[model samples]
Target: MLAAVFHENGGPEVIRVEEMDAPRPGPAEVRIRVEASSMNHLDLWMRRGLPIEIPMPHIGGSDIVGTVEKCGAGTVRSLLGKRVVVDPSLDYDWYRLARLRGYDGEPFRVIGEHTQGGFAEFAVVPAANVVELPDGFPAETAAAAALAGVTAWRGLMTRGGLRKGDRVLITGASGGVSAMAVQFANEAGAEVFAVTSGSENVRHVRGLGADHVFDRTTTDWGREIHRITNKRGVDLCLDSVGEAIWPQLLRALAVRGRLVSFGATTGPAAKVDIRLLFWRQLSILGSTMGTPAEFRDAMDMVFRGKITPPIHAVLPLHEARRAHEMLEAGEVFGKLVLDPREARP
Candidate 1:
């Protein structure tokens, strides 16, 4: 099996493609022969180093779609040879109780963060993490859409309490999660507003069903959103670009509105006025990856074609470094997929 491994944290040059042993399934786990994997901002963050130190020679990728090759003892034997996608969120011991009752628990662990992930020919995961893919669903499409779609669904529906007739504003319109957020909000019968970096992406966001698109490069998008809403402000603001947009996002939120966040693409530190929170009675919620139940509900929509994933580019698996570069440089409009079958030697 060939996998992309990085021994040091730095730039793309640190990532190397080399042969590695295929993983085997443990009890309660399944071994998957990976067909496709997708890149996420989390991949870039891990590669560049975060506050925590990752093990040396790490393989990074979370979104995976593949076929089940083997099931460990006690696993469902009926799942072998089936096409599947993984729910990468790992539950803790205490959280197991919540999981058994179909409720989510805190302190969730994401795959590729605390453990090995699907950047190679074979990866192993708990049987509970696997979801069967519908017939005719492409592996690459499922891999590309899984994480982002689930994230958007959890952010809008679970955390933000998005409802029909609500006005939702999403920052960074062309990114994978933002694009999904737009579509999900629109499908929920909300008026969608998208803030994109350039004119080139305005049409793309609109096509995703955003009712209003603002060019963030040359416009005060928050002000534009306020004007569009007649100064009432948007009911919800999904902002992942932390520091650069926090103040503006605060201004764009309607009174008693909620702002849901998942990442900080534009630096983490922000100086926000305390008065804004109290006076507006705004709620700030932080969300991570979806729970198993949320992932299932979200993927159902994708499998049924209720929402579509936008593929920016598909590259060979060995080109993981270039994919990271593209994401870090913000050159992609949506998810970038890596086809393991096409990986270079």
Candidate 2:
């Protein structure tokens, strides 16, 4: 099997397209013949460097859509040949307990981040992570939406407690998660305000159903958002570009507003003002990749075409290195996919 493997993490140049042994299913796991795998910012981070320990000879692709070719011992034999999307979030039981009960911290695991992922023709994941798609569903579509869909759904809806008529502000709106966030908020009957880096992305984010879009390069979006909202501020602010605008995000929020932070592309060290937080009665949430149930809800809307994760491009699996480069360069508007079948020698 051909895979985009990196013996060590450094940069896109570290990725190599080479033949490797196909992975086999382990107990309660299944081997997926990967049809499509999409890129995430997480892939870029894993390729460059992360604090966590990752498997050597790593293959990075958390959003995977494929067919179950084989099932391991004690697995459901009926799953074989089913088209499915892999839930990249791992260790859900511990994750759920840790969140719900505040138990001692459990090791956080994600498919592409902690273990070998789907930048290969074959990948093995726990059967529990595979969500079967309806017949005739396009695998590439599911792959594109997988991780972004889950993350956006959880952060915007689950954690933020988004409601109809709510005013929502989404920062860094050009990325995959924010792209989906715009659509989800729109569909849920909320007014969506998006902030991106340029005019082109501002336009793109608008097409994703953002009611108002701001280009950070030329506009002070925080003041603009407050201005547009008549100084009442938004009910929720879903932001990932932390530190750079964290304080403004808090100020831009309505009293008792919920602000969910899913990522920190701008760096995480924010000089927070305790007064702004308490004075506004704000709720600051830190969300990661969601639970399996959330992943299922995310994919259901995606597969039904009620929500579409925009596809920037589809490249051969061997071009995973180029995908990483494109994403890191901020050239991609939404998800970029890898077609394993097109990984020609």
Candidate 3:
């Protein structure tokens, strides 16, 4: 097997494709012959190194679409040879209890970040994480949607309490998660407002169902959103770029509004005015990936064709290093995929 392996983290240059032993399934796990894998900002963060050390010589790709080749003991035999999409979220006993009670859980890790992932010919994952792909669904599309789709669904619908006729604002609209957020918010009957960094992305976000798109580079998007909404403000704001845009999100919320933060791509620290929060009766929420149930719900909608996760580009698996470069450069507008089956000529 050949995989994109990084022994030490610093930059994209650290990754290289090399022959490696294929992983085998463990009890209640299955080995997937990876057909496609997609990149997330998480991958970039993992490669650049985080506070917690990952396994040396790591393979990073959380969004995976593949076929079940073998199942280990205690797994159902029927799953063999079935096409599947992995639910990247890993659950622990604490997370299970928290999810059942509808409260925040201890921070959970994802497939690519905490364990070996799918940037290779074969990867092993818990059987429970493998959801069978619907008939005729494209593998590339499924891989692209897995992580971003679940994140958006949980942040907007589950945490933000989005509803019909409500006005929702989605920041970082050009990114994979936000692109999906625009569609999911709109499908929930909300009037979607999107924030993108440049004019080039305005139309892209609009095409994904945003009612209005603001150029973050040119205007005060928060004020623009307020003016466009006639000063009422939006019912919900789904934002991932923290610190740099957190204050603006606060200013854009209506009375009794909800704001869900999924990631802090910029940085997490934010100074807040307690007075505004109380006076407006606003709710500030934090969400990460999602629960198993949430993953299933999100995937059900995706496989049913209710929403589409946009794909920015697809390259051969060996080009994983370049894919990281593109993502780090902020040139990718949506999910970027790697086709493990495409060999260089």
lDDT of 3 by residue, 174-218 (tens): 999999999998888899999998877998898899999999999
TM-score of model number 2: 0.97
Ranking by TM-score: 2, 3, 1
lDDT of 2: 0.90
Model 2, position 209, has a per-residue lDDT of 95
Model 2 ranges off by over 4 Å:
99-106
Q: Can you write out model 1's per-residue Cα lDDT over 1-345, one digit (the tens) per residue? A: 898888888998898888988888889999889899899898888888988756568888788789999999899899999999998788844355766766654556777766778888888888999999998799988998888988999999999999999999999889998898999999999999999988888888899999999998889887788788999999998879899889889989999989999889988897687899999999999977687899999899888898888889989987888998888888999889988888764
Say what the RMSD of model 1 is: 2.7
Write the candidate numbers in order of decreasing lDDT: 3, 2, 1
Q: Worst lDDT window (10 residues) for model 3?
A: 90-99
The per-residue C-alpha lDDT of model 3 at residue 80 equals 95
Q: Counting only residues 3 or more apart in sequence or on different chains, how many pairs clash (N, Cα, C under 3 Å) in candidate 2?
A: 0
Error of 2 at 136 (Å): 1.6
Which residue pairs show collisions in model 2?
none
